[model samples]
Target chain A: MSFKPDHEIYRRRFSRNLGVGLCLVAFVMLGFFLTVEKVTRGNPLDALQGKPYVAAPVAP
Target chain B: MTDIQAQATPAEPGFGDFVQLLKPRVMSLVVFTALVGLMVAPVHLYPVAGFSAILFIALGAGASGALNMWWDADIDAVMRRTRNRPVPSGRIQPCEALGLGVALSGISVVMLALATNLMAAGLLAFTIFFYAVVYSMWLKRLTPQNIVIGGAAGAFPPMIGWVAATGSMSLEACLMFALIFMWTPPHFWALALFMKEDYSNAGVPMLTVTHGRRATRVHVLVYTLLLVPFAMALGWMSIGGPVYIAAAAVLNVWFVVGAVRIWRRDEVQAEADKYAVEKAFFRFSLVYLFAHFSALLVEAVLRAQVYGV
Candidate 1:
């Protein structure tokens, strides 16, 4: 198969691909941060370590 | 090869078109109001969890928007305002929009459950269902009171935000919900007054179409009058302060005055003046909601500073 010159379709497809890629990356980052925050702030890690999980103090 | 390429090539949609299907403008309102709801709650949310909660809420809102566009593509094609939307304009396929909406809806709801509490997630799920199925598919085409009931879907975000923070509901949250719920009818009716032809042509039964323009005008005034109490009541809540109350008092007076002007005008006066009052009211309605929420946010900050919550 022979390759043709770059077409308008390729350009549009590239934009879509790039956008989807960025969104996926953002989602992964958000998930990572959320997990970190959950483990650090709460007693999730303590429970994981077989310690009695003390509930974090919540505001009224 | 050239012929094959020619046959395959159509107006392929860009990234922005997909974004448009999400109704970014509506999502912006959802984000802002939800943020206010989260911030004003007495409970403290870890920064990351708070951010994730808002993001999932926004995504859920965006998913509903995509579903609305997919379902309403036919009517959207007829309406001047919505004619150029992604699905209607054929830039994006209807099925693609539907798939995106469904996927995003599921993802957002599940992710929200992980990031926040089940209560918030449940509310988010219900909001998406209400907007995509109940409001978009049923109420919109069936009745003139569509936006009235449909407005609840929009009003849910703030309450969901509060729930995400506190894992429960509160009077303050309900007050926030009521504020948007009451404001929606007047805000949309003001738009209906000017965009009367769009709804009628699209075969969507808006108040301006079923009832007369005069009736819509009256409804706008009536709803605006009703909205004032809810707006004022929020000021007395824990989230509220002197700042919110003063802002609410001034904004409500201005809003009611605008609604009254809209009510007093007839088609002749409206047409002669190019629907300036109606148009102005529509614009101000956006500011009205934003300012009210901003006032609540300011009050929340002040309370935090004074009492160290």
Candidate 2:
């Protein structure tokens, strides 16, 4: 539908909420990536590459 | 310019009203349960991937809420409790809500597939469809068994979270699903007992409106009794521990006592006291669901330290 002046506020509101939601998602993704990487001392993506973790060898 | 051309139109809504259309209240529950499901799963997700899974799942929840508002606008407009909601109040047009719902639904599903797996994405898509179309559009106005079957939409999130991490379904996932599904009738019907007039006035066929308060009370007690076993079973299963077991035991006793009290009261007593018993039960039901889920998280953490699962 074409925007009437009356519809402009809602349109802007919709656009604004969409931006906020997307930004929040991006922030979460970055936070998780950085924090988890720091905790594990390596890139988390490395785990998904068929190697989640390596175990130390058993003592003889 | 014509006289009409000279006039300035007032703004229809602010940013907050659009957020309301997405039902932030319900979305919070969805996000929390979905997060728990992801966290407690055996397969560990890269934290960013996990975040993406939750984000899309939340958007999917929001999408369903918007669509429900769009479809239920007619009933909502007449109900005293919902009369001022965004769609019903005319702050946002129904078509706008629909457009937003559809767009979010597609975006969430596609993004989830990219972030996780086809199973999780598919489950999310089905959940949105179930809530918006199957439940809101069909079951709601049609049956008192509405929430009974329709509760599946809400129940899917934790399962979706589980699937997001594990890429498969298991008994644990189904148990989580069952907990919400069974808990819904008592939760909503308690609200219905107090808000029967709202549903009646809106022509919605809620149990309290159709079956009378007496039958509704019995239904509440029966459902709570049934729900107790399942709630406790979650504690018995792998996802739970002593913390959960104790919480479920106490919550169930508290819930059953409240349900029993409601069952004993008649309409005369209810009106005189303004549905105090029923209202208390409804309030407790919120805590019941939240606490049970929170306890599961606690148990998961404890087991991680002890059993290393």
Candidate 3:
């Protein structure tokens, strides 16, 4: 019901880990976007307008 | 009846508690491998779809983690390493974790299927099941080989990522999976070696507890040795390059050396050192896997530029 001292410590560690994870996610996203932009040679936002919306093909 | 009724009264879950349920440290490894898999696969999805697929896979990983936290709450409460987990810490109720896990598992699988291919979605579903059921409920308590076998669940992300891109598993993907799978035992065993007392105290059937530290150390060395070829093989695959090969060679050797140090240490020395070997091995093992995968990623980028992959 209430947080203990160990709980506080875990929370701190969790927060720090979460920050690291978010930084990684950001780094990956930036890299992905930059790669996409480089490959397309066009603005990614502009490309999004014509983006195909195909449904997932069923597994065989 | 009275104690059962008391225990059945569910506690409320706050926002932070929900986040804690995900086992975010484990999720980071899953996310990294899955990202690499999607990145280097020959087939490409729209960037938007690719990110979405990875996100869903991450959610699926989190869901499985939540389920594991729920199922293992009892044991986790007893174990020093896990006692602070959300469910065990009373920050969240077990049933709530179960419900959240189920909901997110369905959402992730279905969303991943929609965002990418059914193959990736299917793999996500299976990973969740393997972790929640096979590893957590069955293997963990049943066998000393728990992490040895259970480690497979953690090893599937890259393969799933590759499938998300290519719509099928490939030789390269299998090699990537093998690298992680082989690395798991030693990585985990190193932790177990230091935490043998904790495992014994908690009554968990860890290899260190059941077979003794000498045996566990030997197994750790063996698995670390096995990981060398698998890591190197990834460098030989089409996805690999010279840089990757060089990196894997060095990292694997370093890893094996760490394992060997742990194996050769006498109990008196090990006790005098007090977690030194275990700590170094555990920390370096993390660096080792990251180096291998990062090298692969670097190779993929270099090849894409030089040879158009």
| Cα lDDT listed for each candidate | 0.93, 0.89, 0.85
Candidate achieving the largest TM-score: 1
lDDT of 2 by residue, B1-309 (tens): 656556656546666777898899999999999999998888877766788899889999999999999999999999999999999888788998999899999989988897789999999999999999999999999998898889999999999999999999988899999999999999999999888779999989999888888899999999999999889998878788799999999999999999999999999999999999999999999999999999988877877887776
Write down the RMSD of all candidates, one decimal each: 4.1, 6.0, 7.9
TM-score of each: 0.92, 0.86, 0.83
Off by over 4 Å in 2: A1-60, B1-11
Model 1, C-alpha of B17: deviation from truth (Å): 1.3
| Deviation (Å) of B114 in candidate 2 | 0.8
Question: What does the lDDT read for residue B300 in candidate 1?
Answer: 86
For residue B175, give model 2's deviation from the true position in Å.
Answer: 0.7
lDDT of 1 at B261: 97
Q: Model 1, B177-271: lDDT tens per residue? A: 99999999999999988888899998899999999998999999999999999999998888888999999999999999999999899999999
Off by over 4 Å in 1: A1-5, A42-60, B1-8
Q: Which tens-of-lDDT digit does each residue in B1-309 have in candidate 3? A: 455434453444445678789888888999999999988888887766777778888889999999999998999999888898888888677898999899999988987887678988999899999999999999999899999888888999999999998998789998888889998999989988887777888788998888888899899988888888888888778899899988887887788889889989867888898979889999999999888889888988998898876
- Clashing residue pairs in candidate 2 are none
Chain B TM-score of every predicted model = 0.97, 0.96, 0.95
Separate DockQ for every predicted complex: 0.55, 0.19, 0.07
Q: Fraction of true contacts reproduced, model 2?
A: 0.25
> B25 in model 3: Cα distance from truth in Å?
0.8
Error of 1 at B103 (Å): 0.3
